[model samples]
Target chain A: MLHFKAEIKENIPVSKNHYLLTFTPLAKTPVPLPGQFYMIGIGNSCDPLLKRPFSILTKSDDSIRILYRIKGKGTTLMKEMKTGTVINVMGPLGNSYPIPKKKHTPLIIAGGIGIASVFYLAEKLKGKAIVLYGARGKHELLMLDELRGLVKELHISTDDGSYGKKGTIIDLLNEFHVNDKHLIYACGPKGMIRAVSEFALEKGLKGYISLEENMACGIGACMGCAVKTLKGYKRVCKEGPVFNIKDILW
Target chain B: MNLEVSIGKLRLKNPVMTASGTFGYGEEYSDFVDLNSLGAVVVKGISLTPMQGNPPPRICETPCGMLNAIGLQNVGLKKFLKEKLPYIRNFDTKLIVNILGSTVNEYVRLASALDEARVDGIELNVSCPNVKKGGIAFCADSRTLGRLVSKVRKSVNHSTLIVKLSPNVTDIKEPAKAAEEAGADAVSLINTITAMAVDLKTRKPVLKNITGGLSGPAVKPIALRMVWEVSRTVNIPVIGMGGIMNAEDALEFMLAGATAVAVGTANFINPSSTSDILEGIKIYMKENKINDISEIIGGLLIDNPDD
Candidate 1:
């Protein structure tokens, strides 16, 4: 991991309450993996003290992208950031989703803003994976055009009937023929993740899920951002922002 | 300019140190900071056994600061001495172990073990509740704090004995004097002030622990006042900390009577805060034509012509 300044190339709204921020590193940085994240510092100020952790949405030759929703004070400040402004970034943090086995086909599941964590994986898998993207409504869904072109099959769901299929992402899963031959990779709200975990376990499928938590130090130092696992409590920032669905106690 | 400062018999090359629980075991920020450049590196609180700490939502950001209730999770003493100690031994800096315990004997044992390990210093984290004393914090009562300090002081032969004071008290001076009277070589203040944040929409506390210690620029003024009061009350060196984000803040503490200052929450915001603050302090001394850093200690000029 490294700490360096990166200049913003773009900070544009992608959908209602969602933005796609792109920045280029001034110094060389290691290539971030699918589920890995970066802690982006806001304007140099004491209030809003800690940097906010964001999952890597995409990475190109010279730049990286992060998809964020303006949830609180930090993200609200991040929205006001303009192009060409410099921000401190520490990155390629936490573990990544393991590669799919030869026998198992990849099933990428993303809910709302959680799409940020799985987008890179979908892009990397390209024509080899099927993606199930869900949001509250049509306005909340993001990167549909890009996702359609990247994955083998793209399925979408919305809580309101304004989008593809009505009901939660779990209801949308009923339409697909999933089995042990499929490896589920998911990132979403706790309810969605729990449902995915149960779905995977009942289907005798193995999978991984990415988690989100309020973090400080984004490194292992603070021992904040803890999540319970069968072994005990583990740091979401270190032991994971990603974990095996089977290992999770819940 | 001379930046050297002494904490008890231990002389620091500079007056800047990394606060416990913020810097990890000195390895987490090694990529961003030069460990050798720091005056001291105080690791996270070590207990007799590994602690799982609080459940998720362990930390939350508040205006100008953050609240953290990490529950002092650590690798336990055995793992620390075996794995962590050797890793940090690579750094050319003094290592001060901040210890937390539920009983006086626990503190004594930790102090003597760390001293035997030949560490540079041992800081007693008196903010932890003394389970033996009905869950009241060791620093909550002056006499209890005195007894704890005296026992740990006797066990600590080589390492400098420093008592870390909590600001959640009626009068900070009482505990400062109690520590000195009990043979503590130095005292550091203030550990984070207890505070909480609530989610209005959900009507719940932000942290799973309900309340966490508040640390950052928000607590600076309170820390400064407590440091000033404690410095006047105790004869031993006062190591001030709690919201020291920059050189100006550190200088403010020194002028208010602190011999040294520790950088805590700033590390979360900027990994290289300690080095940056240290560099800033040197520049301040050079620009002001101050020769020795000791000149800044207790340097506040108070004048009352009417008196």
Candidate 2:
């Protein structure tokens, strides 16, 4: 909800085609929530016109991290940036993970790059959650070493059989026994989210899902990122990038 | 320090109005921008009925600008008055609603509906299709523009009618004169230039709608040229826009011929863009020892060998 200049401490490749950007705030800010995001922009350039929105992968007292893959024109510029570059970041935007009132078994389900938003949620749970991550292959399963130490039980799967249990994350869900009393949290591709939402609903587990939609203002002002819910069209950047699975129409 | 300038009967506190679609009814950036400090806040396009905009991939970045096919997505007139008007009325600044429709009757109906409404003015977006004429835009043809605007001008009694012209036309002056002759109090341009972006990988257009309206710094020069041309042809006040991101850009529009300028796509770049531009204008006026903003309007220098 605040805008400040943050200097990039580092932006190094963490995995194939992925980078881990670490930046320190030029101004003081309250600690961002687990699912909050930042609208990051390079200095003065107008071509990429608007700042790109990225969820906070992790954070510490002096620095914050964002995980991104080179998607288009904007990230292409980001990939070549040198360290110590001053990036204009408007953050900790959007709503956060639905923290339950009482402690219970937390099931963190993530697919591919969706793991960027969930890593902090795991930290908030104090290594007491069970995380299930799915990727196309072993190479795509990013931040595994860092992620393994954060969760109590870490389950991984790769479609090409180069890693643990082969198949989609949905197939992994079928193999694993999700406890009846657990609360579910999910993020990933639309199909993956839809399947997990359906799976969680059928299991009668309370859950929230993070959505990825092309955004304009990233802060709900533009009304560009619209998602149809039971109530009709709502802004993903405003109403939520996070929503209860039960309330979402699809 | 006197920044107030009159656009017909409507006097703005300053010349900075947040462009339609960029400001989002003044609620989205209320935390970041001081709405009351602005001269005006123009909300997005509202049609006769609710509209679901184009499918995804609606925006694509270009060289110093961006193309968007939001397709004028809005809550419709009924919903806008019911759900949005009350919230907008709370602001101390002038409120101008930008409205669009497919036909002449729709414009008149909307004009009649808001004639007595609490808002200050109405900006007609003539960039939309004239459905009765098989989707030719009202702004594209001068006669159609004259007919639709004059009929709309007759229906609204309490509000100033400002016609927003598109730059897609060949001779922008023709429509500006047409609007003036049809009783429009003021006119604003250029909505956006028609353009397209292609994805090299897919070998297809980037936006779902193949083409969209381009806005931002890339269109500023083209918009300035049109504003200069239209202002000379029409006696009515001209509100210029297109790639107006900063106070310098606003001053450039004013110097060219715009009575007022709206900050458009820059709102996405900086959430507080409106306020920053307003502040910059104030500083410029102060440093220049200018007492009033009117002194700077149409102050451009054009030279000829004879002179």
Q: Ten-residue segment with the worst summed lDDT in candidate 1 chain B?
A: B128-137
What TM-score would chain A of each candidate receive against the reference chain A?
A: 0.98, 0.96
Q: How does model 2 score by TM-score?
A: 0.93
> How accurate locally is residue A201 in candidate 1, as Cα lDDT from 0 to 100?
86
What is the lDDT, from 0 to 100, of the residue B237 in candidate 2? 96
The top-ranked prediction according to TM-score is 1
lDDT of 2: 0.86
What fraction of native interface contacts does model 2 preserve?
0.46
- How much is B237 displaced in model 1, in angstroms? 0.6
Per-residue lDDT of model 1, residues A1-250, tens digit only: 3899999999999876999999999999999999999999998888678899999999999999999999988899999999999999999899999989789889999999999999999988867889998999999999899989999998999999799999889999877899788899999999999999999888888999999988999888888888889989888889998999998877
Q: Give the alpha carbon lDDT tens digit for every residue of A144-224 in model 2.
A: 998888899999998897999989999998888977667888999899999999998888888889987777688876666
For model 2, residues B85-183, the per-residue Cα lDDT tens digits are: 899788888999988777799888888888768568999988742122212378878999999999999998878899998888889999999999999
